[model samples]
Target: MKKKLGLTSKIFIGILLGAILGLILKGMPDSTFKNTILLNGILKVMGSGFITAIKMLVVPLVFVSLVCGSSSMGDVKKLGRIGIKTLCFYLITTAVAITLALGIGKLINPGIGLDMSSLITQKPTIGESKSLVDIVLGMIPANPIQSLASGEMLQIIVFSLLLGIAISMVGKKAEPIKNLFESANEICMKMVSIIMLLAPYGVFALITNTFATTGFDAIFSLLKYMFAVSLTLVLQAFVVYASMVKLSTGLKLKPFFKKFASVAAVTFSTASSNAALPLTIESMEEIGVDNSVASFTLPLGATINMDGTAIMQGVACIFISQLYGIDLGINALLTIILTATLASVGTAGVPGVGMITLSMVLTSVGLPLEGIGLIMGVDRLLDMARTTVNVMGDCACTLVVSNSEGEFNKDMYYGKDCNNLNKLSESELNKDMHQDEDCNNLNELVD
Candidate 1:
């Protein structure tokens, strides 16, 4: 019998095979194979189904996990501190990512020779942007049910935070509710595992369709733009994130990378941070991050922290500017950074979100929104790469927060049995019950 391969191995194989199949279809002269069969048939159905399945879980998972995280904190003050730190860290990293991308784009000049003016452009309909005050006020959902229905992640986060704090303040009276979320969280995580079983096949269809539709000529024509964006993503993920993790937690890079490679692959394949949260949280637990920290930070990170997207905006802005023969002054670069940073939050969790924010960034600096369509050919591929970096940013923030709180598990993170690590066991829960009265008698109930 053939030995069973791990999920990661299977996913990698799916991606490989999908790429080969896509290339074969791309090379074919007749449009019959790609247009009639691959693009519109098997690949379309499976890919759409997979993305839908993942999205279905996002709201519930985030809601339950975040409530569990908030209630577990036991102290409202600490929760506040965690919130502040997480926000600051996310924003800081985003600024850094964008800054780096701008610097690199300038050096590489990815758009110098690309003349796209003759291409007709359709004006994208953009709603009036919210002011800073409006944005802050909007965080408190007028109707949380509406927020949930619409999948408004920022509103969900705010409402969940308030709910969790209220539960914590209620003390033993809220134990039943808290326990319910814990159970719900566990069930949801199991659902994630079940869904992930389809990842290999789903990823195959997604990749195959992407490559088959996006011709090699378009990809190669803008190879330099692709190279710059890809290079910046790689640098942000490895050099910048690795450095932050090392400096913050004193954790070894080898084990972190070993564990994170799997998460990165999922992020790349799915291109949705919310979709990858279940696995990311699971990986964090296996690496020994405290449940409270991992649950809170990762969900919040997914919703608000978008360093990878920031990098893309920064690079794309410069590339577009160069293509138009527009010279960017220091003030224009600053505007791009500020606009991109704020836009990342304003546009959180929308489908095809990057291009929307890219348009906003372009408008901020007097660059034409039409320039966005010029890069659409390679955007799908770059979206995959940047999404990987985005999730990596979330994981890095989780570790940093975990370390600062002294909740990080250096031993589990470095241990050889990391893959086999399970959730908190019965005996452990019992011991915790004996130690803390406010644990809501979870041991008794769960046992």
Candidate 2:
């Protein structure tokens, strides 16, 4: 029998091949085969199909997993603590990310050598951002079905937690529904596993298409800026996040990185934290994070967390300021941190959303909005880098919160006797079932 390749190895190979093929196609003369059939046709279809498949798992998985996490909490106060801790961790890390980026950008001075005379500047018409009142009101979905239909994650999360809390409060009466949701949650996670099997090919297509279509001229022209952004993202992911996970959970960094390798590749290729959420949650479970922490924190982190985006904004702010020869005062620097950090919450987890939020940060710091044009050309590659950090931030927060709650499974996380953890989960299920006879039997639950 042929040896089976691990998911991490397969993904790495895919990324390598994709980059090679993309460079070849990009250098070749324009031809129908390369343009229509290869780049625009097959690669496009495969890449989009992969994204759609991942998204297909998001709503059901998030709703069911979050419901399970909330109901399993057994106490509303515990759930609140989870929420508070998760948010605080995400925000603080985002601030840290931007602060780090600014320091690096200043030291590197990415905008110093670039000639700006020929750069085309535009006045972007940024859409009005949501106010505190609007955000709070939007959290309480007036119509949850509409929210689900629209794939509104915040509202879905809110409604699911409320329903889960009510089920917990009902005591024995909610056992049937709780059991049903647990079964559904298991089934959804299985579906996520199924979707992940397509990741290698999906990542290949996405990366190939990106490099093929995006020219390297912008990248070469702004090499300094690109280097600064890439370096900051790498440091944040490996150095900052790795240290946090180690300090908080006492888990070895090597094993954690090995487990999360595939997740990082997916995030880099797809450039969307929301797209990576399902895989992040599954990987968190594989590495010993409790379902309650993984499900709740990952989804919520994807929705509001923008550590990577904050890094981009931070570096971009400083770069543009240097480009325009503007001396930023202490107050101006503080404004950038505050604006970028808060703007991350309102920003969605999609491509170019960071650039949009960066505009707001620029306005906050009295920088010229046109300065955004200086970095726009190199944003795609940076977007890929930052998205990976965003997902990593989510995983790091999940591990920390789980450790604090005493729900973390060290043995499973460390790759020692994996079946033992499965056995423990099975035992927990049995205990829950015994407590409520009306609950569905374990055998009746579908794999």
Candidate 3:
């Protein structure tokens, strides 16, 4: 018998192949085939279509899962504890991420003698940013249906939390709606599995389009800024997250990352945390996070947690300050830290969100708004890396909170159980899972 390749391996292979194809495409002359047929035609359609598929389920999944998870908790007070703990972990990590970003940005000084000609932005428009009070008020949806239609994640989360708590209070009288949501959750989970079957293909197309259009040209022009952001991301993901998980839960490093690699690949390709939310939750559950905890924490974390975004804003603030010859002293740095940390809670999880928030950070200390226009070229490249870190932050927070609440499965996380999906990296894990009558429909649904 031969071993079958896992999703993680397949995704990596797609990335490598995509990079090769992209580089080849980049070297070719501009033509109708390259622009219209190849890059814009096949690659764009496949990549965008796949992302759309993933996003198709995010709203319903978050809503139903949170409701089901919150209602399962008989004691409503525990909800307050988990919510507060989750926010604290997210904000603290965001603060720490920005602080590290500042340290590295100053050390590298990416803006010294930076190329002014490389900036692609034609205008100095700074996007409108809501005040802190406005952001807090906005979280409580004016109309939840409108919020859901608009995909306002914070608003949806608030409504779902209140509705779930109401159901939990009503006890047996809420059984019908509770059962309805639980069933809907199962369907949403099924949709995630079906969509993931196409991941390698989608990831390949997305990476292929990005590298083909970008090539190596963008990096050299802004190499220092790119390097600073990349280094900070690596540190946050590997060092910050690894140490936090180890100290908090005593979990081993290798298996944890191995399980998370599949999720990382998708997030890196899409560059949108919301697009990756479904897989993020599924991965946490497989890693032995309790269903209730995974359901609640992962969604909330995705919406409120912006550690990776904070890292970029911190670096960008210093980068812009140095580029334009402005001095951001200690008071300004402290202000940046506080503003970025709180802004993390206010912002939604989506692509280009960091850029919007970057404007706010730069404005806070009187740095030039035109500076936002400076890094637009390479931000897309850096964005992929940051999104990977953002999602890792979410999962790490979920694991730690789960442990604190005594909901983490020690045996499963350690891979000692026969049915442990976390331990089973091969195809047999899927086979084993399908043996259960509850999941018997999974295969048929996909078929």
Candidate 4:
């Protein structure tokens, strides 16, 4: 009999095998394999189905988890503190990321002297822009049931938070409501497990489709832009995040990076901070951060913390400006930073969000939104790097917040088994062993 591997181990194997298969398919002749039914029908359909299932779970998972997390605090004041801390951290980091990206993009001049006419263009569709009054009013859902049905995530989140808080206030009377939600949350997690089972197949297809069409040529053409964006992600991960961790928790940078590398790899491949949330939270807990802090910070960070997106906005703004031969004044620079930060909040956690947000940023500075076409082909490749930075920023913030709250465990942060040590202590191990003996004795008695 073979021993069963854990979820993480299985995922790792899936990723490795998928990469090998993708590479093999990549080398085959277009006539031989491009028209193959296996690639077009089986692999593509299975992969897309898996990704869709995961995405379907996002709004519900976030709303329930966040509401439960917030309301469980039992004190409304603590909710305010968490919100303030999270928002401040997000805004500050975002400002810094854009600044760094702007500096690098200007220095590299990736879009300078490039012809804008050569870029591809698609027909533009007008998007509905809400007024401040409407946006605020919309947050208060007229019908929570309708919001969920319509997949209105923000409205669902607002309703869930209000409901959770109301339940907390009702005290003992709210027990039924709390229990119901708790049960619902557990069911949702089970759903997540089912969705994750198909992840390897999904990831393999997504990557294979991406690379098969574009190959390395797309990356090569946008080499300078990609390099500049990539450099920001690397610096943010190693320099910014490492320094923050060292200062906050007094942990050595080397070990922190070692533990973080694997999680970062997943984030890079997925190109989604939210998709990487579970792994990021688990990794942080393993590194000695308290559950309370990890539970609070990581999810919120995944939703709103976007250092990588900020960096992209900065670079994109500069790239657009250079393409149009416009020198960005100090005022324009400040406006870009402010708009980018705000846009990050409004953008949904979906593919092409960066480009949409970048388009918004460009529009703020009087640059043509059509300039987005210049980078669309290479956007998928760049997304991986940006997402890794985004996930790293979230973890870094969790550490900082945890350290400040005095909730971080320094010994565990540097120790191995950071993930399971809390649940499987020496005392628990002994208890389990005794329980096994008792069960055996009872079985013998029955015999």
lDDT of 2 by residue, 8-86 (tens): 5666677667767877777889999998899778986877676556556656765775677566545335488888888
lDDT for 9 in candidate 1 is: 67
Once fitted onto the true fold, the runs of candidate 4 whose alpha carbons sit more than 4 angstroms away are 1-77, 80-82, 117-221, 416-447
Which parts of model 1 are misplaced by more than 4 Å? 1-78, 117-221, 416-447
Predicted candidate 4 versus true structure: per-residue lDDT over 198-269, tens digit per residue:
655565565455445444432343578888888887777788777776776676777677878989888777
Per-residue lDDT of candidate 3, residues 107-132 (tens digit): 99887765332322233322235555
Cα displacement (angstroms), candidate 3, residue 199, comes to 28
What value does the lDDT take at residue 10 in candidate 4?
Answer: 56
TM-scores of the candidates in the order shown = 0.58, 0.58, 0.57, 0.57
Report the CA-based lDDT of candidate 4 relative to the real structure.
0.67
**TM-score of model 2 vs. true structure:** 0.58
lDDT of 1 by residue, 85-199 (tens): 8878887889999999999999898877655433213332222355546545765799999988876555676787678768988889999999998899778777777876776
